[model samples]
Target chain A: MMSRGEPSIRLESVNHWFGAGETRIQAIFDASLSIERGSLTILRGPSGSGKTTLLTLMGSLRKVQEGSIRLLGQELRGASQRSQEALRRRLGFIFQAHNLHESLTARQNTLMGLQVHGPGGDAARQNAAVIHILEVLGLGARIDYLPEKLSGGQKQRVAIARALVSNPEIVFADEPTAALDKDAGLHVVRMLKALGRTRGTSTVIVTHDTRIIELADRIITVEDGRLLPG
Target chain B: MTLLLHLLLRRTPIGWLQLMHNRMRLVAAVAGIAFANLLVFVQLGVVASMNSVIYLTYTPFRTDIMISAPSPQLFGGALLSRRIIYMALADPGVADATALHLGSMEWKRPGGMSKVLIVYGMAPEAGAFAGDTITDQQLAMLALPNRVLLDSEFKDVGKDGSDMAIKQLSPETPLEFEINGHAVSAVGSFKLGSGFGYDGALFMSDQTFQRLIPERTSGTLSHVLVQLKPGADPALAVRRLNERLKSEHVQVRTAAQMIADDVNYMNTEAPMGIIFGIGVFIGIFVGLVIVYQVLATDVAAHMKEYATFKAMGYPHRFLLGIVFEEALIIAFLGFMPGVLLGSGVYQVMAMATDLPLGMTPGRALTVLAGTFVACALSGSLATLRLRRAEPAELF
Candidate 1:
């Protein structure tokens, strides 16, 4: 059983590569880190610095290649695809592209986050939960609007709602506010920080946005696939 | 099963939403599938009509067993000795035997253009045939000298662009035409539609038939139709008749067996039947291609969504469910229009060719099942592209 003070994410000597043979290029090299529960951690790096790759590995979205990653009390190295899927269900992901299904309304998109949990309780209650999350994300009025009808910032906010609606133990966000203005971006980061303080939910965000850096409880930087001494 | 239902209820709506996202693409995809379905329906419809006519030729005959020469050809076998009928009757199970004389003659229209026509000659008093298509009154009219009942469905075009069968010789008009140089009036009409081999049919008495073509000997017979006594098994009676008529150069078959043999010969041996089978194959092949193209495009458009689902802890099977759901919807949706349009085409073809082209519930169900299989196959192929969507790649 995991205790309250246990780290939400733990990595040790994690290594990853892309391609094969002469074309093989290492993306991450011997990275090790631990993220405490209810803390907001931000990964800062330039493009191609392997920050996104490290986040994906930690989030259980990608296979751990040569090292161990333990998330939410499960070891990820050499884990079966089924185990990885089960682990993924306990985590949340927000991508830079804000990959919301265009055909679904904002409320429907948010409901997708809960779908992986399968049906439980009353459907009305589930809908109420989804609606409440969207309202809290400042998307209350746009709940019924499609992605095409909403602006880029609204779409990103909807993505955030989707990632957060399940009350995931940890959230892995890749440039969640890359498309948002300063105020909207800060609002998103502030929401993540407040959720950490209240719900004991850990958050790991990968971004170049310096404005939200002060809000992160811990800041980690990556350069050339190697962690920089802070 | 509960799990399956829950999975379906959960994933199918997403499938529907994705498909409905781009209305134009959905329309185009459905249209493509419907076109494929139409092709298969029409081809199978032709085969069904061909089988129907073959069976229709035998439905009017009231017999439990039929005796013919070995390997009977088109109209029937060669003339057999009447002693065979008496031999069949020798069996206590045989109630009665009727001799039918079947032949074809050139029907010379008023304009001197001739078409081949099948003729059935039986004694009007025998009343052996058992169909309401030719009423007792029509059969009684056959007793008159040189009078025959014409098939209402027979159609022919004349040099003057008039319907030779309808405009010239209708029951009300009663135009006299020459069959084998014997004058015969169209006394009444029946509903025996034409088959592939002949355009029209005429029912006349045995005496008139012998008179029209004096070549047939008085005792010669084309087929001997035998009915068993009540509670007697036809199969056992056929076996006894085959044993008794073994030396008479006659083959004994049940009525159903005879019709089945005729249908089998048409489907397997006849060139026209082979062509129809080839058409059905071509239709299925073309349908598969069209559906594959449509489904492949759909998968490509939704690649990103599939990746997102994978990242959300949904299994590959879940993604496949969505694809198959889209396929099933298209299958059923497209089948409705295909059947409707195919039925319309059947009516047009039946009118134009005078063949008994039609749609039956069984044939419709068969085509629907085929459409589902075709779409499912296309969905399976589309999954190949879906496999490329990895959540890791998405990052």
Candidate 2:
């Protein structure tokens, strides 16, 4: 898949530490990896193996230390918060907990994703985009239901819809299937792969599930904080 | 500008609806603020009513000066002679001087028994009425020598049950009571309170008041009510009178000065003023505190939600704008109930209340406006925590 290599994402010797001096927890230890564009890349690790840290670092959730990280041709090592947020907008984020705003309905939450990405306050565009995404997610019937009202799988689907609705160049899902049953979980992974290939959005899913790792175009394993050789 | 308004409105849909979900808390918040507003309105209204009560002395009988004996502060010692009545009138600057009787009388009724009645007796033809023609009740008693003026409530002034219910006493009737035993007659009676207590005053010529209380006639006249010519200065005349009466125990005061003194005396020297002041301080203090607490609590509960908005690219200015909107809504809502409750209180006080309760439209408006401002301040104050919540910390 990476014949001579075009990197969709490139991290060079990234070092990240958390907390301070004596209490410092090294979340990432000189870790670096690259993935080709238009491919489904899976980062396989234990819960605290820093797979999330790697995804966030690649997504520009935090500034890099001791490294040059390029995401979608944008240099992230010294990017400002504004530039980083803009980079984040170009990537879809699906969290484990579905961190959707509870006050808003499921449909409204999906629409919020469109609102955040589109030229702000384009009501018609936001509505159309949300309608299209919900229909694709098979959530047309439960659009008006709140997150509490929706089943765990439906919530995850809404989260997936939220993630893909923006048509981001990168879709990074951190344990999106963690909270679901086996069937719902595989269904989400299948949908993510299908949406990635069809939309041509580069997908990077972090999971401990062996079942989903097999579905990735490339699966990279990590022991402790270090990536194992493919 | 338009964009700012639009975005703020769109974002606040959550915050606005949050208030509606907790109806009891919202009602409690509004009721607390409104009660404070109402307290201020009622206090101010009653204070205004006190001023309205004095229109009789201050308006119609526009007397320039009043010369009262025993000096009103120690009001009971105000006993004087009727002899100087004509001598004071003789002065060109005086224009005219009327001797008035300020004393107590014993009156007896069949059911109510005998009680001391306070009387303000002046000439049958005095400036007390300003020139308004006598009402029938005032006219009936004036025609008879001892026909006492009775309002809807006719008090027995004589205390002796002699002419109970006045089967209409004749012109030459003499008052039987003795005040230190000086002879006098109960001549003509006019109307009761067409000036008396919380109700109206009963009018009678000086002779009738003197005859009823012989002890007062022998003293140097209770009070000399005087009117001056249009061009004359009452202050100058009062100064001259004060100088002349410097040797005697008397006070010569202008009507305006007397009214001011009366107002100041009541506000400072009376318990009513202290109560009114306390009520006001308590109202403002409690209202402000309640508003502050409500705002702070709401903000605390919604801090995470607000932080999410802030992290989602919303500016601090937009957040501040939402706070102001919340403040405006809370304050305005709180103010209405307060006004309604306060007006209800004002109505209660207005009926049969000795204390004048008046709500000047301007004062009412000011109180409500003050409620709004206090709420806005509290609402803004509640947002102080937003400064500490970092967007990163929020996530």
Model 1 chain B worst lDDT window (10 residues): B159-168
TM-score of each: 0.90, 0.65
What's the lDDT for residue B74 in model 2?
Answer: 19
Candidate 1: interface RMSD equals: 1.8
Docking class of 1: medium
What lDDT would each prediction earn against the true structure? 0.82, 0.65
- Model 1 residue A209 CA deviation in Å: 1.5
Clashes of each: 0, 25
The digit string of per-residue lDDT tens for model 2 on A1-230 reads 22334577988788887888899888777777777777889998777887777887787666687677888877888887677666666777787667666656777777656655433566777778888888876788998887879988888888888777777778888787777777767777777677667866788988877767777899888767788788
lDDT of 1 by residue, A72-93 (tens): 8788888899988887888888
In model 1, how large is the Cα lDDT of residue B132? 64
lDDT for B270 in candidate 1 is: 81
**TM-score, second chain, candidate 2:** 0.72
